[model samples]
Target: MSRQNQGNCDHQKLISETDTPSLHEDANTDSGDWFADMFADFEPQNTTDGSYRGTMAKIKATELHYQAVFEQKLVEANTNLKRERIRVTIKQTGNSLQLRATLPLKPGDNSVGKQKKQYDLSLGIPANLEGLKTAIEESYELGKLIARHTFQWNEKYLGIKSREKQEIKTIGELLDTFEEKYYQTRQKTITSQNTFANYLSVIKRNFPLTHLATKENIEAIINSVQGNKKNELIAVTSVLIKTFNLGFQLDVKRDHVTPAYREIPDDEKIISAFHMFEKFALSRKNTNISDEIDTWEMWRWVYGMLATFGLRPRELFVEPDINWWMSTQNIDHTWKVNKNTKTGYREVIPFVPEWIELFDLRNSKPLNILERKVEKIASVQNINWMRRDISRWFRKVGIQFQPYDLRHACAIRAHLQGIPIKAAADNLGHTVDEHTKTYQRWFGIENRKKAFGEVISQRSLIELQKNEILALRMENETLRLEVEKLKLLENV
Candidate 1:
């Protein structure tokens, strides 16, 4: 039996050695109990480099909270803003880190394309998102300029209590608002409308100027406009003068208007009275009449009136009030011109016989109703009424010349006459120096003759003085003889 058992064992050994190795039904997996004990959530499956994969992770469930705060400082010296975006994605480029922001263009805001070459500036953006970044940067940049203007505007409107809204992102808008608030309401002269409108035009069309709202920029812009080859240099130069005087004080600019590029056009100085009478007063009937007897008689009358005696149109209109014929007093006597007006200055103007005749015809006295209403001339705001009346008169007379031209024409005529410079200045309410400079060009040959006549008159005064001295001596001698005779008669 031992030998048989030995043989079976030998046979088994030979089978194990020769045949393919056979395994048990299941291998023992419990040998990794130590690993399982050490790490219950993870286990190595293979004998190779040991690493395990888990279906669910025990990683930290950290609540990733992000808070982004944006702080912006305005270009204005006194402005700032704080904004927050909870979920904005912060991006870091090779050069800088930034956050993409979506900004909307406000209504009426100027477009990027509309900006002038000088106005357009660099806002760095990556090639990947250029448009969006540019828009964001530009909004803030433009906002800065607006903020600066707004602050300035507020300071200007300091004393006046107002419910006025603060707007005006662009320089054009700001100036428009200021003009409406300040100039249109307060400006005294309707004739100044066109002058102010010209300023408005410059503010709008000049793009480079719009960029320059500050004082320095304004001067630069004005200089730039003058510099431009396309525009009239005089127009721009005038704008600079007016803006310096009237524009909102941006601290960089002056409060009053300066005659920086002052050029007084000879025509601009004194309006041609003849032209104005023909344009403003005459009926449009071309009768080929002589200058002495024009088809337009009323204008001729106006010319004669101005040339004969210096009278302002308003003064002519005021005759019924004071009843010049009844009172035998001019406006200077009726009302203290200087006292009534803000500035105390008198109206030293005089009227001719022709003007008096016209006044007599127009006079209506309902206890002087015409005079009562005309104590103060009605306001001619924007010159709508004045323009309408002027247009009608011009159309009738068949040309274009404003009523102011009459004043200038009268000034020229007086200058042509041997009227003293001071008298001419006083009649027209101008400084003597101003009148001299303006009308020197218009003094004709007749004027020179009148001037020379004055020299002859001066010489005549000297000769008359000499004759008076001789007469006084003769009278003294005669008086002495009479006294001696009276004494002798008394003795006899």
Candidate 2:
């Protein structure tokens, strides 16, 4: 029985030995072979006699521990990434940090392949999550503020804050944009085009964009040119204000560049000038000299047209088919004078008898003849030259007035003749308020008093006539009574 138990124990020991190999034996065979193949360049110093296997085992254990630690760290990193609400990406080029907040897509938004909308913080990388969150919140608030003002989330609104860094850094560039916008939208007339061109040229030549950007700089520019070139300054300043307002949405007041005070000439001087030119033109017409007749006739028509119709110089030279006659024979009788008008179009009545007579004479002639004469007159080209010629003629005739003064005189005449202010303004192509303000000085209290006095005097004259007629009838009755007494005495 003892011998049988010993044999079973030996068999159990043999099974255990076969199941588990010795650590040294395994390290020398399988582990050593794997380590050598993996790290062939690793040269372990075999200083102790049997230290090689132990060293290999220690290295394997160390590697396994570190691998487990590395796997744990990777899992923690992925979990932290899932917890992040805002993803911050830092760009190296602009040194700007972009924060993308994970928000639900807008209702109509189809973010099929598009990346989420990211708000640019334009900041450096924050030291921590708290700092980053603070920056993102601040940026989001700023964006909200910008949107509140009705500005788009674009460079245009951004440029307003950083104008110096904007592409339109110069005044010329701004004006160019303004002019382009103006011409694109507004109706273009030759006079308006010329005027805008002149404005652009003057501004480009005189003022720099940087200099006119601020109010103080603009004021300084105006002050420098105020004394001698006040009119030019006024024009340039107006253009500048318009350009800046349209381009940059700036508000530049007209009062900032007030024009110098201009003295309006007396009404008598203006009226006298008109009469003087009329008499001179009539004298030329009466000469009956054939060669000078056409020239004299042209001047005659011009004088009558301007004085009667209160027309600008350019209106006289409109296409003759336009029929400036304002006759009842035509549709309205209120002639529409729309040629080169500063305020567009206006309707005027033929108030002057001479104007009617001149139109009659013109209609009597062939259409081609009238057109030829008009072209001949317009051939003078420059209206300014025409003004100079008219001024020179006035000088020759001992009158002191400009061609524009004639229009002013017409305004005065309209006021004195009891024409309604609105009617006069419409005839003159001006707003009633504008006409009133401009000609207020001409419509003096003294003139009103004189008109009232004249009316009263006429009524008093009628009363006096009635009283004189009654007294004469009484005297006639007394004479008849004397005659009757005389007849009775004769009969006795």
Question: What 10-residue stretch in candidate 1 is worst by lDDT?
Answer: 60-69
Q: How far is candidate 1 from the true structure (C-alpha RMSD, Å)?
A: 32.5
Q: Cα deviation of 203 in candidate 2 (Å)?
A: 2.9
| Whole-model lDDT, model 1 | 0.39
- lDDT, residue 446, model 1: 54
Clashes, model 1:
12
Across residues 71-119, which tens digit of lDDT does each residue of candidate 2 receive? Answer: 4433433333223311323222221234333333433558797644444
List runs of model 2 lying over 4 Å from the truth: 1-115, 118-178, 201-216, 225-296, 318-334, 354-398, 443-453, 462-492
RMSD of each: 32.5, 31.6
Off by over 4 Å in 1: 1-171, 180-198, 201-346, 351-426, 439-441, 461-492
